[model samples]
Target: MNLGTYLTRSARYWPDETVLVCGERTWSYRQLDCRTNQLAAALIGRGLRPGDAVASLAWNRGELVETEFALYKAGLMRAPVNARLGRGEITHILRYAPVRVLVFDAAHREDALAAIAAAGTDCLPVPLDDVPGDDVPGDDAPSDEIPAAGPVGVPYADLLAEGTGDPVAVEVDEDEPCVLNFTSGSTGALKAAVQTFGNRLANMRKQLMSDESRPRPGTRYLACGPITHATGMGLLAGVFGGSTTHVLPAWSPEAFLETVEKERITATFLVPAMLTMVLAHPGAADRDLSSLTSLRIGGAPIAPQRLREAVALFGPIVAQGYGLGETTSVVAGLTGQDIARAVTEDPELLQSCGRAAYDTEIRVVDEAGRELGPREVGEVIVRGPDCVREYWQEPELSAETFKDGWVHTGDLAWMREDGYLFLVDRKKDMIISGGFNIYCTEVEAALYEHPAVREACVVGVPDERWGEAVKAVVVTHEGRAVTPGELIEFCAGRLDRYKKPRSVEFVPELPHNRNGKLDRKAVREPYWADAARRVN
Candidate 1:
């Protein structure tokens, strides 16, 4: 059955219950079900087929949630481009994925248009605005039926109205690609994790079964981060379990606290950075956050100290999980009780990211893929139904990552005898700052574009608010002359704002190995010398 069958079931069970809330707007289970059915029908009407891709570029909103389910019903791949990514990266994603329809809001109007032009694809733009619906694009695109359109393409409302308000029961194989999860690779190239329909079904099962992330009836889940990423993972589970999902249009500490109090949000997920900000917010103490039952944290390795501080402020509701894009759902989790135990009896457990969750099998392995004994540090590999089997269009990378039926997550960690995972270092050439993955080579490529930058090494430095901050060490060309601010701005223009270096340092010389290759580890050593763990 399609994943959207759950939504239809929910609407039948609780049609009048609020299923989604975004600011002043609220969507009941009936509204969401019918609207998603209509949207799914509309996309199919426009000639989109199962396995064909549809990408969305917008901030967190009810429509993104709607689009997710609609795509599920249509059996289309939901390719959600990160709203924070720059124009170039956006173009790279547009070109990389087989995206046939690009849905975006006004905030990203110029960038979306420019990316389409640069990508040179026949992707029809579906703007989320009430523009005049005439002379739409894609009228001749081999379809028996076409929706009413505007100058750019079909306006979002017009497209929805164009949809027949009937359930679209498109049959699809479980192995079909469901989502194109795009990420910047260490090679400075963009790649997408092809999350299969089976992977998503397994994900839903995990969420429904896991104690840490399970949504309960009458519970409201506040998404405190971008819905395109981790925070949005809970939407389907919320609907399945009859929970109302409250979306934060834009995340702020004040907004988060207020929403929880106003909506009485029972469960939510936040990255370490958002948790840090909320903990440090002055009004946090004044807010009535007693309604929150689960405040699950993930996206990056959160400091044990922050976990304790949060428990003191928010009671014993703090939890943690560890997973990645390749793993559609968290394979390991630290529950609230475990955190409470860590605070009281087991201090060491606080440093661990729980044990293997549900059916997921996590192992610490040597270079030869041999499973290491307890307390032995090695690469972490995972095998589970929810894990992705391939990268979109990259067989070599797929072979390297998804080998022998296990996804080799490039995180070096050890497993306790009891199965808790303690991440010690990152084996990949990447950094996680504020929960966003930034590869060193990806940033270095941007810095190299500057005329004065002879050599550049990007690393993550210890940060208070963010788990880690992007730092750049540069060796300038002789007499070329460039200020740190200028170099930083240059990268900001070329890359995403979050991926740009927070601080830049000039060095006369950079460390190199005997083979004459730049020693990235040596450049990272100084910044992490005082730290306890290699990764934050």
Candidate 2:
């Protein structure tokens, strides 16, 4: 079945139910269904054929949601660019994906134009200022000139208005390409993970079956991060269950809390960094967040102690998930109940990302592909319907990462006797000091336990005697003071002396990548510049 059918099904089952809420605008199932149909017909009318690539560079908005459904209906491949990406990365994706139509939010007009010029492609540019049922953003008075069709791009409203407003009936096989999900190019060049229609369907099923963060009727799932990332993976699940998906146009700790209270948001997804910020926000304690039932955090490994703190502040409703872009949404998840158990009973389980999700098989394998036993740390590998088959066009990388029908997640972890998976650190990020392996995540988690530390990132620096020395970069909480010696002493209590950071550098804030994960590569780049080899 076409994934787009989920939206149509919701419209038929509950026509008046709200499926989307962006800012002041709300979209009912019926309205969203018809608009997407119109959009599909309109894109077809503009000479786009099935299998053509359509790229969208926009923030979280009603139009972006409509366009995704339209792509599924039209059988076009979706290439969603991160709005924060610079012209260079944007151009690379544009040319590599060979997008036939490029759509952008008015806010990104300049960047889109520049990328288009750089890529030198014949891609059509469409700037969306307003869509049907969308509120115009401006002062009490009217806004400035709205650009239409000439050098800039065509207005989305004009295209939608010209279409027949009927559903575009197209045959899309379940295995057909659906989304070209781009990986965060933190380690190297950007690559697109080719997610198929069947893979997405599997994602929907996994999300629905999950106990902790499942979406149900009237479930209000709020997304503070850009929906183009992991946060947007829940869109189809929302439609399937007759739930409403709320999007924050911008992100701020105070603003996010305000939305949860104002909208009575029942569930939401945030990266660990965002979770830290929200908990530290002055207004977080004062906000009325009792309505939130599921607080799902992912995109990075959060400190177990920090997760316990979040549960304390937000009730026992915090859930943690672990997955990569290659594995659609989440293949393993720590349920809210699991979190509650960790806080009250088994604090050790807090480090595990729960058991494998429904229908997903997880394995820890050594270098020779032999599965390891309990408490034995090795590379984590997973296989399931939700996992991607290959990277978009990179055959070599596809073979390397997707070996033997399994997606070899470079994360080093070990499974417990009871089947819980405990992540150590990224294989490449593991540091060896004096022949002792030290996981950076372990160190960071220790730093988070200190009350004065707001955020922490640990890396290995070049050293003579130790070969590679453990170094820590930290961001302390506001109005809190802590010295390097104090933080090192704190780590000494939780970890081995060799694993403790030999030196610590305090900064006002840590750098986060476009996807909100701490930019460890960026933080470590300067230190390695003068070294002959990054690793000792």
Candidate 3:
């Protein structure tokens, strides 16, 4: 069955229910279903064939959501480009995927055009604001910066209006490629995870079955981040469960709190960094946050102390999920109740990303591909219907990552006797100083225990004596101060002396990637620039 059928069923059952909300504007199930059909019809009429690549370059907006469903209905692959990515990166992705149609927002007009020109691809450009028909009310006119569209470019509205309103029931294979989710380029080049239609449906099932994070009828899911990424993964299940997905046009801590109160947001997802900012915001506690039922944190490793603080403020509703682009959505999750138990009986469990999600198999394996025992650190691998079977257009890389039907997550972790998975660090992020392996996350977690430390990222730096020395870059809490020696002493008391940061660099703020996770690679580059190699 097509994933688009979920929206059609929702429309039939609850046509007047608002399924999408952006600011004061809202789109009912009927409106969204009808618009998607029209848009899909328009794309098909414009020569879009099954398996054609349809790319979207935009932020959190109603049109982006509509575009996703329309593409699903049309049986085309959806490739969403991160709006913050550079033109060179965008060009590489476009040339690699070889997109046939590019749908972009007015804000990304210049970048999209420049990337297309640089790539020299003959892709048809469609302005999202002009997608034919009045799918959204008061959608401001296209910005003057948008180029005049001749035959090569078509107004989005014109195309939608020309299409039929009847539902598009394109026969699509369940295993056909549905979405091409690109990994963050923090490590190196971006690679797309080839997620099939069945994989997406599996994602929905996993979320719906998980009692803690499941979406309920009339539940409002507030998505503060870009919906095209991790936040968007919940959209299908939220709709399937008759939930409303509220999108933020832009993100601000104050705006997010206000939206939660106004919309009575029942559930929401945010990266650990965003949660840190929100907790530190002066008005955060003052807001009426009682409506929030599930506050999920992921996209980065969060300090246990920070998790405790979030639980204190948000009550026991705090949950943490862990997954990758290759794994569609979260394959491991810690529920709010699990958090409460950890806080009371087993505080160590708070450090875990929770057990394998329902129907998923999680394994911690050594270099020889042998499953490691409890407390033994090794590569974390997962297998299930939600896990992508391959990477798009990269057979060699695919074989290496997807071996024996398990997706090698490239993450280092250990599983407890009780099945909880505790992340140590990324394999590439591990530091070897003086022939001793030190996970940067362990050092960073200790730094966060200090009340003065707001955020910290630990990396390995060059050293003559130790080869590679442990270094810490940190942001102090407001109106607080902590010197390098003091922090080193602090970590020394809590951790092994070798694991302590030899030096600490204080910054007003730490760098984060597009997904709001700490950008450790960016921090390590400058220090290792003159070194012979990154490792000792």
Candidate 4:
């Protein structure tokens, strides 16, 4: 079934049930379904056809959710742009996707218009400010003028009101593409990954069946991250299971906790860094987080100590998962039982990302793509229905990324005898010194064991003799100080001499990408600015 069918089914089963909650506003499934149908009829009235692309530049709100269902009903692919990106980046995605119509909320209207202008594409803009807001932002604010670009200009409300005489019936195949998600590439380009209806359905099924993935009706889901990423789309899985979503326009440690207490949020997904920020917030101690039942975290590995502290503060609700944009969301998850085992029995297992999902098959393979034995570190490859078949418009890269039937994740990991998978580091993040491969995560894990260290990122810097030397960027706890020599000594005691960082730089914090992963590209770009090749 298509992703849009979920709305129809929910509307049928629980028509009057509240489906979405944005701040003080709430939308029933019946209201949402009817409104989206009207919006779809509006899009059809404007000449949008099957397979046409509809892009939206907006934050998490009722309108954004409406546009998703509307585009699905219209049989058009929805391409949600990353609102955090600059105009140039947005322009590249729009040009690459070549969308037929673009929708922008009032907050992002200027950037969306700028991106369309830069791409030299004629797009019909739907001004969300003109729509009747209900307890959400712009509820009582004056309607702002939305600059017109195309001849057919209509307010979002007026278009919804002028519904078509009959809903146009369109054939939708389960394998048809429904969403286009763009990922940052190694060469600084955007790689659009097409998510099929079947892929999304498979993800929803897997998540709904998992014992640790339960979200009851009326459960409040807090979405604080960028909706363009995989985590953002994964939040929809919660909605599919009959939960209400609460959106945060932006990330703020104080606001995150306040919303949790105020909204009585039951579940949320955050990256490790964002979780750390929430824990460090002064208001966190004062907030009542007893309502939370599940806190799914991923995007990066969580330190053991940090995991312990999170469990201490939030109860045993924080679960970790491992996956990438190409996987359509989660491939492996550390469930509540796994968390309990790690905390009560074996603390070392807390560092692992647990086993593969029920629908996924994971294996560690060598350089020649040969399957490796347990405890042997190699490339982590996975094959499943949820995995993407190929990257859009890149035959060569697609061939290299997908071999045989497995999708090469480019992440180095090893499986234990108990079937748990432990992520070492990214293949590119491994530091090679005098032909010896050193995983950055190993060094960082050791560094985090230091009492004074709060966070650490390790990368290979250019060296004249060793080809590449280990370098670390560290963030210390408040009122704590660790000299470079002292940290180097700390690593020397726990790790091999070659694995120890030759230099250490203490900084306030490390830079993170939109998905909350360490921005190693940004960190290494400056050091290798004049280098001939990225590799020494």
Candidate 5:
């Protein structure tokens, strides 16, 4: 069935139920459905067809969600661009995707128009601010919302309001593409991973049935991250199960905590960096978070100490989800049981992402693609219904990514005897020193155990003597101090001599990509600028 049908079905069953909440505005399922239908008719009138692409450059807001449903209803593939990107980067994506229609919020109007002009693509800009924000109440006057300063061609409200005809019926195959999500190119250039309706449905089913995955009816979910990313798309799991989504336009430690208490949010997903900021916030101690049922975190590994502190502050509902854009959001999730296991049996287990989800087959394979046994490190390969079949318009890359029947994750990992999978590092991120392979994650994990270290990232730098040398970038706890010698000594006690970092650099925070994953490439680029290639 088409994904649009999911919204229609839900609307029919629970017409008056709150479907979306942003600030003070709330939209019932029926109201949302009608708006999407009107927007879909408008899109069709504008010449959008099945398989045509429509892109949105916006944050997590009510209008963004409305555009998604409208695109689905119109049978157009939705491509939500990362608003953080500059004009050049945005232009490249528009040129690559060749979308027919582009939507932009006031905040990103300049970049969107610049991208459209640079790409020379036929794109109609739909200003988001002019759209009605009259669902519930509480925010500033809606009349004050002006068209974001750019080439304002059409107002989204005008288009929706002008189209008063009945919604057109569009037939969509289950295998038909629904969304196009771009990968955060931390290691290489970004590629669009096309996700199908069937893939999303399968992923949602796995999450809902998982022993640790549960969201009560009318649960409030605060979306503070970029909705254009996989983590944002994963919020559909909450929507499918009947939960209200509260959107935070941007990430702010103070605002995030305040929203949680004010909205009585039951669940929210955050990256490790965001979590660190929330914990560091001055008001965090006074915030009432008893209503939170789950604090979902992923995109990077969490330090054991940080995990402990999060549990201490928010109870045991901390959930870790493991996946990529290619996995359509979640491949494996560390549930409450998994967190409890980490607290009791082996805290180190918390460092490892939980076992593969039901319906997913995970295998660690050697360089020749030979399957490895438990405790043996190799590239993690996943074969599941949720896995993307191919990258958009890149047949050669698709072949390299998908081999036999499993999708090569390019991530190095090992499985324990208990069936838990431990991520070591990205294969590209692995540092080779003196012909010895050292996984950055292993070294980072060891460094994170230090009392003074709040966050750590490891990368390899060029060394004339050793061919490559390990380097550590650390973020120390507030008011705490640690010298480079002390950090090296700390790692020496936990890691092998060669595996330990040869140099340590203390920084306030490590650089992160748009998706919130540690940008090892950015961290190592300066040191490897004169080298032949960034990696060995």
Candidate 6:
């Protein structure tokens, strides 16, 4: 079975309905389907085999979306390198996958050429012009503007123009690799979670089945982050549900607000950092966002206070999910109603990421693989159809992370009696002070309660007496101010004496990984630079 078949079916059902929108370009179901078929045929006709690797290195655009479906139709492995990656990292990915073709936007052309040269591979480049109205034969009387060309590589439009517009059908096994899901390398060298066709199919199904954030007819899904990563995962379900996808070329608060207001977007996804920016944007109060139905946040844990602010501004439409690249879909979700209920009835539920989602099995396990009971913090492990079993080519590393049938997430969390997962901190990020354990998230949660604090990152610093002490790096709202001593005192009231931050430092901003999660590893580096061991 192939996933592209679903798109073919959607086109049959909603031929004239808009399926994709990026910038000023909009592709109807029929147009997108025909163009993808042409793309698939072009690739296969150009000597690409079923299992050959194809990569896209670009910012959010219609071309990347087209490439994703085209690869599925052609039975090729989709390796999407984050556009924010450096030249060296890009080279590593191209050489590691040895991608036969690299499709990129004009913005990344120079870096793409350098990576190809450095990798010393026969990787052909496909330059996408991103001409807003360029179209296939049956699309809008055919664009008079030709597909843009560069000094090296094929023109993206030329390949589409060559297609017969007939469907490109390929036989593919469900368990075969479909995507090389790479991490942002916040912890170390980038690693890919090899997700299979079956894994992604299940991911699509999980979203469709759940009542939490299911896409339905007339659903307008707006992706505010890079379509190559987490926010883009929702596209699969949206496509299957015949929803129109709106892709933001880049993220800015004004752009997001304007698009949502203009398109009357029903659903959208944002990472915590993006949400923080949106909540802080001055004009957000004036935007006509009443049409919004779902505001899903992920890619990082958001402070509950920030979540509350989101609900206040967005009218209780805010929700969140917990998952990673290894888990191809959300393993758990905190629904909008759940957040609302927390505000009224169950205040503590705001701290929870919600119960195990759908068919996923989650456990907080000890070192011996024994499941811990309620309130017992341990490693969070998940097993399900959506959970990936291995990395692309790193067997040893794969074995270390994936054991038995469970993906051992290094996150430290505990389960409540009702099965909700409450993450304390990442195992590595937890600070041990004089044999007393301190979860950075717990301390940060306290700091977020202060009215002046806007963003906070907690880390461990070396201390002669306690071995390690908790340090809080904070960013306050632009017009708000709070002294370090006052903030420390505020936290002292909410947390245990041992759990309270020993010191606080005000900063203009906190470092965020390309995926938009707070970069805790970067925040801790300076404090641990002179330590005998990075982690005490």
lDDT of each: 0.83, 0.86, 0.87, 0.79, 0.79, 0.87
Cα lDDT for residue 394, candidate 5: 84
Model 2 residue 521 distance off true place after TM-score fit, in angstroms: 0.7
Runs with alpha carbons beyond 4 Å of true place in candidate 5: 130-151, 165-169, 184-188, 531-534
Candidate 3 per-residue lDDT, tens place, 408-463, comes to: 99999999999999999999899988999999988888898999999999999999
lDDT of 1 by residue, 320-376 (tens): 999999999698999999999999999888878898889999999999989999988
- Tens-place lDDT per residue, model 2, 473-522, is 99888889989999999999999888999999988788888888998888
Query: Which tens-of-lDDT digit does each residue in 1-536 have in candidate 4?
Result: 34666777777888888887665678988888788888888888878776678888766666778788777677778888876666788888778875888877766666767677788876776667633332344322223454545533455777788775343335578677778878877787888777776777787777887776666587888887765565466545655777777777667798789899988988888888898788777678778999998898888887777777788889988899988767888899898778867998998798799899988999999999898998999999998888887787789888988788788999999999988999998888888999999988888888888889888888998888888999999999888888999999999998998899999999898988766778877777678888766693
Model 3's number of clashes is 7
- Candidate 5: RMSD to truth: 4.2
Residue 463 lDDT, candidate 3, scale 0-100: 92
Return whichever of 4 and 5 wins on TM-score. 5
RMSD of each: 11.8, 3.6, 3.5, 3.8, 4.2, 5.0
In model 6, the clashing pairs are none
Worst 10 residues of 6 by lDDT: 134-143
Look at candidate 3 and tell me the lDDT of residue 217: 76
TM-score of each prediction: 0.79, 0.95, 0.95, 0.92, 0.93, 0.95
Prediction 1 TM-score vs. true: 0.79
- The parts of candidate 6 lying over 4 Å away from their true place are 130-150, 184-187
